[model samples]
Target: MKRVGSFLGDWWRLVIPYFRSEEWPIAIALLIGAIALTFAGVGLEVLFNDWNRRFYDSIQNKNETVFWREIIFFSWLAALYIMVFVARAIVSPYLRLRWRRWLTSHYLAHWLDDRGYYRIELTRAVDNVDQRIAEDLNQLGQYTMTLLLGLLGAVATLISFLFILWELSGPLSLASIGIDITVPGYMAWVCLIYAVVGSYLANLVGRRLIPLNFMRQRFEANFRFSLVRVRENAEGIALYHGEKREADSLNARFIDVFNNGFRVLMTQAQLAFYQSGYAQLAIIFPYVVTAPRFFAGVITFGVMTQTASAFGQVQTALSFFIDNYTSLAELRAVMDRLKGLQIATDEKPPTAIEVMPQPGRSGVATEDLTLSLPGGQALLENLDLPLEKGQSVLVRGASGTGKSTLFRALAGIWPFGRGRVRVPEGARVLFLPQKPYIPIGTLRDAVRYPDENSRASDADIAAALQATGLGHLTDRLDEVAHWSNVLSGGEQQRLAAARAIVFKPDWLFMDEATASLDDAAEATVYNALKKQLPGTTMVSIGHRPTLRKWHDRQLELKRAPGEVGTLVEVPA
Candidate 1:
């Protein structure tokens, strides 16, 4: 009971937001209407149970007119039932869709806001966030609709059938059991006891399903994510002839999925055995209990049949949780995933690296900066550097000398550090990583991304592409494709250069941005930047000796015996 209570509490916290969202009016209205129709369906079921009694009694008595009249009555009831059922089916999905759209939008906003996605990656707090937002959110809608409607239907069935069961079932005197008491509503009591015992047994058999379902989702997502990773790195794998290795890794992940799935199937088979027998036995148990009265001439066939129908309805209502145990377990897992994602998204990035925007201040500078790796090991400490306006500086160092880490600290994204980075307020700055991000879109969109909606002119874009030696792509500006996958590594780097020509930022930081290109091609990009954005304060991180001519000054990171690395000015 405590576990169930906790689950409901979590479920309510995850789901209540949609009901209070801007779409709540229509969502709530549709929910009420659907629930109302469900009750109407339950009421129609009661009418059918009563109709069964009269219809069968007329047959037993060989009455033609009454039978025909009851048949006509049943036709009306059936038509109304179908109408209500269809309307419910139509409206419920529309509501689910609307709710899902709102939730997906909300989650996306939260996940993308303030670099929440990046922090989640750094923390590793949750896995397969893509699945959580995409698949689990969809499941939330599907299972929420099914479970809520099923519960409401069950409640209505119980309300409408319990009275009929009570009146139809006479008091059973316990004379045979050597007791004097008479039990009223004996069939209702029997059904309650039967459903309770069945529910207890079903829970015992199915409790393992919750964690298995959770692990199954994780394993399946892990396998799928691995496949996506392989697809993304297909070129590297093919070049290295590592397909066999990747295949083995993929198979290993899938084996986890396969083993867990077998466990789920085995447990489900056990549950199905018990539930199937319980349900089939329920069909006959009511008649068996009422048989003595009917055979002893105390009641008619119609009454006995009506008692059976009512007992079935009541028992089904009471056994709602038992029947939906597996689905409920899956739903629990889905809700837990979404809740974890919500918590992760809400977490703020570390403030260890502080970025301050100083209005009217030109260029970028850092004061007494200390940076550390994620494992609490210091990389650089007490580092101070100041860059004046319009000066091109190149940063060079051996690998593992904290060159890229310093750049990250300056960009204010490396969280495990203590530093103050001062950037001129309202100044546009851009950071180009080694492998540039080319969103799957048109050539123009990919070049203009992080600012796709900016008011850059077409002539400007074409000129920038031509200036960066990508004149061949100028004609394909309107073509939509996965630009990253379609373009070669050198071409992608050239595209990043073209972006800089278009953006013309006040400051630019490049971390091995031209590593993929030939020295001659790399020189063309640097020359284009020097010629085009002369006043832009540029900082480049590279190892090529040929890059020295473009910069006015160079900063080199040199390691001491035991202290963090030191930054010193080197002759350009």
Candidate 2:
């Protein structure tokens, strides 16, 4: 019972927010319409049950006139049933889609806000968030609507039919057995018992499906992610001749999917077999129990048939869980995954380094800044670094001395330490990494990115491209393609340099941004930065001796064998 309560609480948290959102009016209207249709469909089933009795009795009594009239009545009844269900089908799915849209937008905001995606990735706190957002949200919306409507319809059917079955059931006497006992509404009691037992057995057969479905989604996402990795890094793999290794790794991932899928299939088969036999037995069980009364001539053929129809309706309504146990299991798994993502994103990082805006300040500076790995090993300690406006400083360190991490801490992304980083209010800062991210889009957008709203005209963009020795791509500004895959490494670095030229940030931090370019090309890019944006404060991390001439001062990070590194000012 506690587990059930927790499951429902999680489901409510995931489902209720959309209805209370700005789209509530339309969402509520569609939901109410679908529910109204559900009740109308159940009401129509009652009418059909009555018609079944009239038609069958007409045939039993050889009354053609009454039989023909009842047949026409069924036609009208069937038409109304079709219209109600059709409207329900339309409204329900439309509501699901709208709910899904709202949820996708909401989750995307939380995941991207405050660089939550980066933190989640850096800490390995959650896995396959893309799948959770893309696939799990869709399933959550779909199954929530399906199960809610199904359960409501079941309740209505059960209420409407149970009374009819009871009234038609009458009392049964067992004096011939010498006990002289009587059972009231015997058929209703029998149906209630039968449905209860069937549901219990169905649950027993399919309870493992919940955990299996959860793992199944994870395995499938892992396999698909592996394929995407291979595609994205095709050049690296091909150059290293790692196709065979990739193939074996891919097969290994798929084996998890294959084995789990086989177990799901076998479990579903067991459930299907049980449900089919139960349903077939239900068909005859109703008439078999009530037939004795019909044979005894205590009721008309119409009453016997009506009693059987009512029995079927009540039994089906009670068997709702039995029929949908698998869907229920899948829904449980979806809720668990989405709830996990929600919790992970909502959590605040502990001991996060603080970055504050100091208005009226001229450039970036750090106070008592410390940096560490995710595993809590200190890299840099008690460092106070300050730079004034228009000052170009180069940061130099041996490999793994936290040069790049210091950049991240300055960028306010590395959260594994505590410190205060101060920057001027409303300062535009850009960090160009070793391998710049080239979004899959047109060349213009890729160059203007991290700020797609840049108003840099085509002429301005083209000039930046030419300045960075990428004049060949100027004409293809509007052509959309996967820029990362299309551009070579040196070309990509040059393109990133062009982006820096276009963006013209007040403070530009480049971490080996020119490492891939040739000496002449790198010189051209650095000279362009100096001439184009002379007021920009530059902090670069690089090992090349040629890089020293472009900066006014230098800071080197040095550490002993087992001590944390410290930054020291050095002559350029």
Model 1 compared with the native: what TM-score?
0.97
Screening candidate 2 with a backbone cut-off below 3 angstroms (N, C-alpha, C), the clashing residue pairs are none
Candidate 1 Cα misplacement greater than 4 A, ranges: 559-563
Weakest lDDT window of 10 consecutive positions for candidate 1: 557-566
Regions more than 4 Å wrong, model 2: 176-178, 560-563
The lDDT per prediction is 0.90, 0.91
Number of the top TM-score candidate: 2
- Candidate 1, position 410, lDDT: 88
Collision count for each candidate, in order: 0, 0
Window of ten residues with lowest summed lDDT in model 2: 557-566
* The best candidate in terms of lDDT: 2
Tens digit per residue, CA lDDT, model 2, 237-279:
9999999999999999999999999999999999999999999
